[model samples]
Target: MKFLSAAALAAGLCLGLGATQAQAAQKALLIGAGEYPYLPPKAQLSGPANDVRAMTQFLEGYWGFSKSDIRILVDGDASKQKILNAIQSWLPGATQPGDRVIIYYSGHGSQIPDTSGDEEDGKDETFVPTDFGRNGDQASDMLSDDEIGRALNMLKGREVILIADSCHSGTINRDIVPGLAKDGIDARPRYLPFSGSSTFFADARDVEPLAREVDTHLNLSAALPHQLAWETNGSGIFTQTLIQGLSSGQADQNGNGRITTAELLNFMRPKTEAWCQGVEQCRELQFTPNVSPRNEAFVLQPVRPAEPVQTVTGDSSEDVSDVLPERERDKIAVRILPGAMHEIGDEVQFQLTSELDGYLTLLDLTAEGKLVLLFPTDEDRAAGKTGKIRANSTLTVPDPSYGFSFVAEAPAGNGKLLAIVTQDRVDLEDLLAANGTFEPIDDKMGFIKEISGRLNTVWTGDTTNRSVSWAAGYKEYEIRP
Candidate 1:
């Protein structure tokens, strides 16, 4: 669902600008008010405070922003006027024209009437500050999209990125009514319970077009219109994944040692989806996080350990996501054990785990680059064979009931085993009936492309054929003569 827009193109252009404007000062204003003072007790959140704290650490240690360059507002300090001042007055005054700016919000989000008439849906998205409704009317406290856009216009020509971790962000359409207050409705993956209400006001500031250098734009949001951003262990999953990509270098898809904005989206979308489906609190209702267009891409080649790899080809520690550009999820995991060497005729073992209930697809690669279907064989179809893999359960491959074992064969060299987790079963009767492995892949990198693009039909949830969610993962092995 990632499409391109003018803002995305401008953001991409900002990445190219980095090579020349190396001196641009990096600045950030992180806002998250977990304790909405005026709202009832059930409205409080535990994630936003943790989100701002986590981002402060990342911006300072990983992205190299000085502690002084970063500003934070959490709980009692994050009033509506203070947040506006921080962005509109404080940020513009402190930063130069070309400074690299980052603005993040992680908290409860609601909607108000679109008094400006720009919205076809009659609702404008808004982020709740700690002091919502404190200044006479709630609309004055709510931060609308246009208001934020107008604030970004003051940046003149700064390269800006906004990470909005909230609900109703994709295209806010839900209306709030007075009702029973709920706990973590936004954080629990449920639709707004009609208790979080706010009315529209006509005082919204008009917004000008974004500066040519990308003053205000975001390529994606933490969740979509109906989907809510959930938190675990006091941290928003969206921000946690963002930090993981930045610190772990796992989002570097092309393996050129550079993690582009496009690459990061490709990495985050599936992982967030998988996490939502995996967690018991969020599984009932959730959808893929909405993605916007960035025709131009910015590079995030953060310095990490010396583990570099191209798409699909990697070390023993690397998995399928290292090579595949799309379809990486956190719900399911596949690991190759001991990462040791073996001789011909030796059986290979694997450990596959899923945090939620799902189907399993196992594929194999010989040292010769030939591909084979290791599961759902013409052999085992019942007894949960090729059936639902229990959540929180581990499946050890090469079991006697599976009929066939993974006995290593000739062409003694290094090989790989891939384990894919899908929400539904993929019927591979064509390959299973072949009674053997497919011909050696003409191109090693093209192997995954072939599986996802051509050979495999059920691994994705696109409109064409696949209607289920899936994740890509693998493990490496070796065979000696």
Candidate 2:
């Protein structure tokens, strides 16, 4: 029972940046516009709602951002005034020097004539509010690049992360353009064009972004100017993928307990591109994110590495008996081939030898801090192999006939392999991330809690008299790029 605490800690890689933010914590302004009163129904988007909702839940739930600090302006609330107020007022007022500031916008992005001459293309990229161009007021309605630059300037010299899932600039872009929705896929571009009303007017302003070192500022543009940002299944592709990478610890490349700015960019680009080619492919449009300050980097999320843990051990000659304490009854033998540190795509194997005869459960704590059941996978069960392991017998994971091999993947970080010998079979179906291999659980704490509770239930009654006994051993390793 005491050993499971270490397993829980291995899974619950909590972030210090999230927990202890008292005054200089994270603050965000989320803006999403799904409906535009001035635009036609075809211009109406179905993604912003999902975008803002997912972000809010992740920020508050996983990142430990205070709900009050995260100002959400969705749908009707995402008017020009509200977004400006949140950006220029609420966010600036709530932020401190070391605080992390996030400005995420999801909706229609289009180009208005460059009233500001700084744009090289002679067009200013702008995001439309829900009531954009209403009352023939495009100047006050649209969120232009110049306007965005000005707003971001107020947050200068701070840790700022700006993600605009709405495309900036042209209706016809070379990078990733919006066209007719793909056959049978409800993919839509989050870009709206100036419809009907021809007289487009705007106040001239300077085009200047946050002038800061790369470490303090990270800018992510979903699609370059004249390009189209895509969304499908009622969510923005960029936004959904970004949230997944950040939440699942996929961006914590090197598994170093921290996610760096470079890691984030590297993680997002390949993952998003892969997702675009998946089932219900995203328009087949080439996906690209424009990131600036190519060299310098900073930690995006600060997660803790598990402290060294002690496992109960006994000699192989010891017999399983009620007189001996559970910890002293059995020594778990576990080994991994091809060394500890591995690069992506390297195939790995595990060898487990237990001193007692019992059901064996092998678990892997991924470099991304996800718990996976490596033993008793569906293939192992289907092959008619039970979970039991006899004393002095060796068990090889993925016995070749099971038809699967363990291959290393990205988000390189510290990884742990655990072997537990139990008196009774522990049911883990509820905590299972998926069938065959597992998916990373989003709520790690809840997952840990369930595991601990289940272990308690399985190992019930007094310690001395209890026939149930379990011993666990784990090996920690690292994965590099």
Candidate 3:
């Protein structure tokens, strides 16, 4: 009797050990919007709504998450408070350390003035519900990014992932024509019917602190404020690109059949750029980490990938100029296009500083005056490390505190570099201008776009160089040295 009991107990213990091995960390929050009575007809197809639904399916089916493990909120009905409640409820309790949490949003996203200092622009990111006030009169309706970030911080887990499909300030744009209002009978056609009980007018102001800003054509449906601009992006851009990266095997760069954060960024960057070339557009697509996990063992092994082969070129003597901050116009230091030009792969450096914590952004203009290079803030360099950012033929020093310089690497002929230090960071701007002036590399701005595309078009986490994607406006080039 003792022998039989011992054998039975041993078998049960073996099964328990096997069950523990199969467990993994996985949770998701999905949101979308489609139904809107006003403005651009609410995307009758509701791209964002469909997009989030598909994402939910992929996570539950292929990512090993159970249906019940995912939480979904959709449409204008997916209000700020409701979304917050869902997020709070999804927090894991007493789970093992490696578990991961994912949050996804697909809908109109806008920015509201954040009087609080938590955000850089003092603007908080919010989701535009069908009922969101296109005119900024209703105070209680809008949500802020800081508010959402606070909720995310409240969760006990350190591995929280944030996937925002919302527009940030001037990044996304839908233009409204001025004369659309006075064009006779059909000229003032209201896109959506609004109860004229309130004079709804959109706050007509340029988005703050962005390198490029666009005016949008937004309304409750399409008619309020007689064609004013709003700070929101349609949902389709985030949805389509995210799906392409995850589903088409493009994101699985290592042939491992699983996705990583790096792969996702790599795959989505170019795909999004392609989607919004000219028509309603999103300028800067940002990927931020909500929580950084520490010392957690991942089921998927981390792999160190090979670096790019440095294309060598002979060093030429670079001209050094004092880059002085002209206090005449808003204390901004603007780049003056040099008269002479040289070949590609030339290096130039800038010595810069900053009094306040503001971004040091660089823009590489295309021949058509379209923006090609966008290396903003910390995204330009890994944290704590500072160096050069190659924008086609130009190099920029994009740091806040100390003076620094950059050497040009990725080759292109010539392009102009525009640097903007906020009105607040006047001291740093003055320091940089007094220290350096940029060197000229090429003649025309045509290839500048191509060169900028090549340098900035890096997929963050992929081991494979061939599979790495391009920047927001992916351009194909054929520049001969």
RMSD of each: 18.0, 20.3, 22.1
Candidate 1 has its poorest 10 consecutive residues by lDDT at 1-10
lDDT of 3 by residue, 125-224 (tens): 4555555555533434555555565565444322445554543333322332111212221111101222222423234323221111111000011101
Assess candidate 2 and give its lDDT: 0.60
For model 1, residues 1-481, the per-residue Cα lDDT tens digits are 0000011111211222112233356678999878877766666677888899998888777766777788998888788778888988878888865456788888777666667887755666677777875654456568777787677767754556677677653322243322222344334331122223454232322221111112353434676554567666577888888889877789888676567777888888889878766654455445455444342345553211123212223234243333332334355666654344767666555678886567676766554434555654545554446646777798876565655555556656665556666555544344444532333334433333323422222122332222134555555566677
Query: By how many angstroms RMSD does model 3 differ from the true structure?
Result: 22.1
lDDT of 2 by residue, 102-171 (tens): 8888888776666757655456667788988677746546877677767765764345767778765343
Question: Cα deviation in Å at residue 404, candidate 3?
Answer: 56
Candidates in descending lDDT order: 2, 1, 3
Q: For model 1, what is the alpha-carbon lDDT of residue 42? A: 60
Summing lDDT over every window of 10 consecutive residues in candidate 2, give the lowest-scoring window: 13-22
For model 1, state the Cα shift of residue 363 in Å.
53
Top candidate when judged by lDDT against the true structure: 2
